[model samples]
Target: MLRLAPWKVASILAVTFLAVLLLVPSFLGTATVDRLEKLLPSFLPVRPIVLGLDLQGGASLLWEVDSAALTHAQVETLRDDVRGKLREGRISLSGGIAVLPRGVQVRIADAAERAKALPLLRALDQPISNAIIGTAGHMLDITDVGDGSVQLLLTDAAINDKIRRAVTQSIEVLNRRLNESGTKEVNIQQQGVDRILVEVPGLQDTTEVKKLVGATANLEFRLVADPGDPPNEVDNLPQQQGGQIPVQKRVMVAGEDLTNAQTGFDQNSQPDVNFTFNLRGGQRFGQVTSENVQRRFAIVLDGKVISAPVIQTPITGGRGQITGNFTVQEADNLSVLLRAGALPAKLTVVEERTVGPGLGQDSIDAGKRAAIVGGVLVVCYMLATYGIFGVFADVALAVHILFIFASMALIGATLTLPGIAGVVFTIGMAVDSNVLIYERIREEAHMGRSIISALDAGFKRAFATIIDSNVTMFVAAVILYLFGSGPVRGFAVSLGLGILTSVVTAVTMTRMMIALWYRYKRPTKLPI
Candidate 1:
């Protein structure tokens, strides 16, 4: 246990040097880090510690999914599906399809058509997987009411599945939107079944963040309908400027087919959003434009008509542009929304808060004081208790703290107030393993054992106890991380890492220092 190889010493020194190097950027100013980034080699990591929202101060938003809007959209889609199925089967409806909150109903005039429609509509009952039992359930429940009426209702399982899917898609869309807008270290997570929690650090504009996340950004292309078109075939959508425009209900191309979108200047030097479509959308767009030359094409976004232009010629290049008297920022925002795609459902702001930097600085100061006081007390107690060996332990404790922060910076983990508490708590625990070893060594020396024999036996015997205690603490940290959220997770990370670092510095590092001391001085009596 007292043996120290030359390779082992080299490795420990190398790791210590790297830890110090990795930690340098955390103490430097942002401009200094930027300058060093250019001068340093590409392989060296210059990443500084990332502060959490509570530390850096930013926007905190809680959004809830619009269940009513989702239901209405789903029912509208079902009504359209029912209409198509009846038309395809050559079954005449007595009246128009009636839309419900969660389903659709249609009445067929003839009994024979009803029987044919019953089977046709039943075929639309999609098979969905039951997540709880791992069984299959139908998404739509088809029932034959009295007379020639048939009702199709959406199942509870289907509604819940759609809500869950919407929440997941919304998170992904928000992540992409925020990241593209250059918002770094943003935290977006699912709070509950229908709510999302978004915390963005260092956000300057809360309104822009809200706008970026709130807009549904649903984009569609429809043909401008003439006055003679059927009522069911046209929809009067509000225009962005004013008034209303009648557009065909059948979408010529949807935003889903968009492959890329970017902000650019038009021929008139006005800000505009340029977009490209995928293969299928390109073919459909070309076909529509070729068939409807000189007709107006209306661009609808979120149920509002943004622009309508006459199709002079077929656009076969799969590219298009939208110009709507937009400023530079508006054009950029539109491009970002288009590129991020549309949210599955509308999200309303349920709660909003902004943390200021003053509070964060106070938190930092408080944490610093707690850590410094705790570390000083530990250093004094160890030095007074174990003398020269305590100095070795103090050096190891400092290295242990360095390892914790360096590892966090290397992995880009955010540090919160709770994380600081975790680190402070770790300061007390860092000396426990050393105290145990020292006590064991003192007991062996009192038993008339030689100095080297006492040191070796003490380390070998105390190592098991050290491993057991750290293992239990590490397991608890793992559990906390798995089950907790946000700040709790931050605490778990620091505590877990501190356990590992404490083990290294307390056991290996202290033992190496003691072994080197013994080899040079050949002490007649152990220092305890």
Candidate 2:
């Protein structure tokens, strides 16, 4: 057990050097790190653990998806499609269709047309799944509801499917919007049904985040339906900064055609969102502008008119600017939204909170104090118990701290206040395996074994107990991490990483040190 090969020596040296190497830069100031980053090669490892919202200070926003609104929109679209289908089939109905519970009630003018209408309505029924995990089924059912009346209603599964899709799509869009803002360390995830959670670390102001995430960003270009129509003539007019603006129902250019959007100053140094279009959008935009020379075209976003300029010449370059009389920040936000595309459904803030830097500093300072107090006590206890061997254990404990932080940085784990507490808690536990081994060695020494035999037997006997206990705790940590969120998740991650590092330093490093000491001095008696 005291034997050490050259390769084994090299391996141990390499691990110690790496642990110290990864940890050194973390102690340096940010300016020093930046200078070194410029000077160093690309392959050198120098990353810090990302701080959580509690440590870094940021915005926490809880949003509830308007799924009921999605259902209403779906019903309206279905109603329009059904009406169009009936008109195309030349089916006559008196006073149109009445929307009823679970279906549309169409009262036919003639009883003879009822049979014809039933088949037509059935033809419009969409294919959908009936069961949650079953095969495809029909979305609607056309039933005869008394004399000359046919009802077409959507299936429960289809309505539910729409709701689920809306929630998922909203989350995805939120992620894209935040990502477009060039923001990092942002967490956006689904909370419960129809709810989303967004936490942005290092964000002091919530205004930009709220604006970017909440903006529908639904952009469309359409011609003026009636340039002379009075302002009060429109009911479905889009709401804008001034009021509702009337635009053609037919969309000339779609936002989906947009490839990029960036904030830029206009010729007059006014802030504006400059946008580019893809190949398809460019063609359509060129055709529309060329055909409608001297006619007004409106650039609309989220039902608000952005610009309504009369076409003087064809714009074939596939690029344009949206002038909304916006502030610089507003223009930047609009550009971010335009680049991120549109959310499939609307989102409303259910809860919001802002974490200031003062609170975050307090958390960080408290965490530091806890870690220092816990570490110093552990070191003192180990030193007092086993003397020289306890010194060895303390050294291993320090290495465990290095390994834990390095692992966190390497794995990109977020560190919260609870996570710091976890690390500090592990400080007390770091010397556990060594304590067991030393106790076992003491037992062997009391049994009259030689120094080498006692050391060998101690490590061999203690390893099993160490492995079993660490593995059990590791499993619990995994379960906690998988089930928990936010601070709980941070705690689980720190605890889990600390467990592995502690096991390594205790069982491996302490054993190596004792073996080296035994081989070099050739002692007859052990220190413990």
Candidate 3:
């Protein structure tokens, strides 16, 4: 028997509040969770362990972004910009600049032209500003000194940094878009400076996701020749005569005018994507149609012509239809893509897997069965060995589990098989504290101490050992969580929380019960 002070009683109550936090949300659902989330301080760390798709029977996607292609396109665009600036300055050079494997070089007719061209090249640099321009005899060699280049020898580090930042930003944007579409448990990670990995759990329409992710949404309005029209004798139509009404030809509107799109049935009962454009797109379409009536217009997406229809008259309603040879699924996917827009860089599907809901349910069931059996066995063994004191420890162990589960529910941590195994392992370890205490009590009793004296001494002597063991395990779990990935991290989470709750229940709650019992019905003889 032992006596607990008022401070100890208050401490026990405070610890019990943690149990309430864990269990209340589980029973009440997300509304309570939302309230708790807002009420909790921002600095208070309470991030829950989210379940992976394998355990939850959801969708997993592996996408690879083509950073190399993106880099090449960006570099080419920069080169063109630089060339335009050089031409505008009217500085005649011996040869046009060429992008080399290492850097860029331009041969000038004279050393004076090279020196005059250096400032113009530097001014044209929008992305690569720290360019080292030097005259190598009659030729000027331009090398990026910044750490931003994609090539090995080019020292431009700024562009490389920008690429990494852009990739990260793109992932964040994609994550927001997917989340808006109600996808849960999404994991978006940058696989290098250029590639990205997106995992969306519970999403079945992977094709739709791919389409949405692939589009760059770069809307451009261009006038294209109708296929029905005779091929233009000239290679390219000279710039359209400004303000001149040339013979009306077929005109087409691009997808940029689209504000919203959906999959619906056409009059022929065939699946089609219906689109509505914003005011700008609608006005542009209406003008093109009004001016080019009786001519054919082509609808294009990502450079490929999808449809061509004759302009009957100006359409001002801001709405249009895309009729195509489409199946129901195809139409739905196209609509989804159009609505989501497109990614800046293309995303290639690197890996994919779908787990059925049935498998997840089975795992849940098996986990529950194993946990119950293991917990019951642990409780029974502890009670049998420690007699009356053991029963008190068993009660504390029960409280520990209650708090553990409550914490999970409160934080919305997904319970998986490995997580369940963590709980079972905790159950086996929870007895260590009680066992140490009981052994110390027995040793004191053998020394002929009174029951109350032995009980007090036992708890006091065991406290140091209990603290040392649990703290070391807790430190190990923290390290595991910091470094481990996926399921291994889950195990670490449960173990760390278990050690915390076990100490509170075993030392605080059990001590209180023992203190109250000894105060009222003080026993001289030991039960063990």
Candidate 4:
């Protein structure tokens, strides 16, 4: 152990230097770090440690997917599809399609028409992709209603699948919206079957964030129905200006086809949202406008008609503007939502809490005190117990802490309150390895061995025990990270990182320090 290679020594010094460099920004002010980042090399890290919501103060919002609204949407869509299919097949229905609680039902008095309509209706049943079971089930269950009616009900598997999709899509949409709004370190994840937990760090006021996240932004364009149009084909949707407007239920274009949306001013210099569509939507839009010139089309957003304007000429440019009584902020937010696309389903806020910066600062101060006290005590104990050997361990322990923060900064890990606890706990753990080695060395020296032989034997023999203990602890950290959520996972991350750095500092670095000391001092007696 005393015969340390030149390359190993150089490598150790290089790593220590790099760790210091990596941790530099964490201790500096944000403005200073920002300036440094601009001046520094692109490959070098200048980003500061990201604090968690608990540490930096922000909002924690728990949202629940509106299963009732989701079911209503599905049933409504199914009803429309059934109507379209019956019309496409030229099959006559005995009555209007009946909307059931879980599905839609249609009666066909003619046996021949029922047989013809059955194939077209069955074609609407979508196949679900299940990872474990492969192509497992269909989205719809088609049942014969004994008499002349056929029922199309949503399957349990389909409902579950829709909920999962809604959660996933909501997360993606929220991420895009919040990130675009310059909210940093926004943590969004699925909490349960139908709930989402969103943590926005550094933003105490969550009103805007909540508004941005909750808005469904489901934009649709439909032709204003003529007075003579059938009641079943027209829907009297509420208008933003007050009262209701009769519009055709068939959507001319939807938000899904929109490629881009931006806040702009209309010809009247009023705040509006300008949108551009994709190839398919543009063609369909142009066709609708060309055929229905002089007729009005309603721009509907989240079921409310924002505007209903007469189409004086064909809109073949694939671009349009939505004029509404909107403020600049509203227009901007609307454009953002449109650009992000609509949520799969409505999300209701079930729980919400905001952490103020004052509380966060208090927690930070408490954590700092704990870490400082723990580190100082450990340092003092080591020095008083082992003399010069203790100094070496103390230096290594400092480097170990540096390595922990450096690793965290490199990986952009957020530090939380529990993470601070983990760091303090690791401070004691950092010195434990040194204590074991020092005790082992004392035993060897008492056995009549030379100082060099004792030191070498101590590290070599105690190595296996150190590895075994640290390995088990590291495994525990891994399990905690895998199973735990929020702050618990933060604790696991710090603990895991501390274990790794401690192993390096406690074992190899300390051994190297002792080896170098002995090489120069040529000590006849041990320091301990």
Taking the tens digit of each residue's C-alpha lDDT, what string does model 4 give over 350-388? 999986553557668888888898888889988898999
Q: How many backbone clashes does candidate 2 have?
A: 1
Which parts of model 4 have CA positions greater than 4 angstroms off?
59-73, 76-105, 111-165, 168-197, 203-354, 357-364
Task: Please report, in order, the local distance difference test score of every candidate based on alpha carbons.
Answer: 0.87, 0.79, 0.66, 0.87
User: Across residues 193-238, which tens digit of lDDT does each residue of candidate 3 receive?
Assistant: 5677776544566876676676665433344454454655212322
Better of 1 and 4 by TM-score: 1
Best by TM-score: 1
Which of candidates 1 and 2 reaches a greater lDDT? Answer: 1
Ranking by lDDT: 4, 1, 2, 3
User: Per-residue lDDT of 272-330 in model 2, one digit per residue for the tens?
Assistant: 89899999999999999999999888888877786888899999999988887888768
Better of 1 and 3 by TM-score: 1
Q: What's the distance in Å from true for residue 94, model 4?
A: 4.8
**lDDT tens digits, residue span 1-528, model 1:** 589999999899899999999999999988899899889864468878877777787888999999778878888888988889988998898989988778998988798889889988988888777657775567898887877789999998778778888999999899778755221456789998899988876665689988898787889999999989999999999999999999999999998999999988889878899999999999998899999999999999989999999999999889999989998779989999999998888899999888665356766888878889999999999999999999999999999999999988887677777888888877777799999999999999999999999999999999999999999999999998777766788888899889999999999999999999999999988777
Clashes of 3: 17
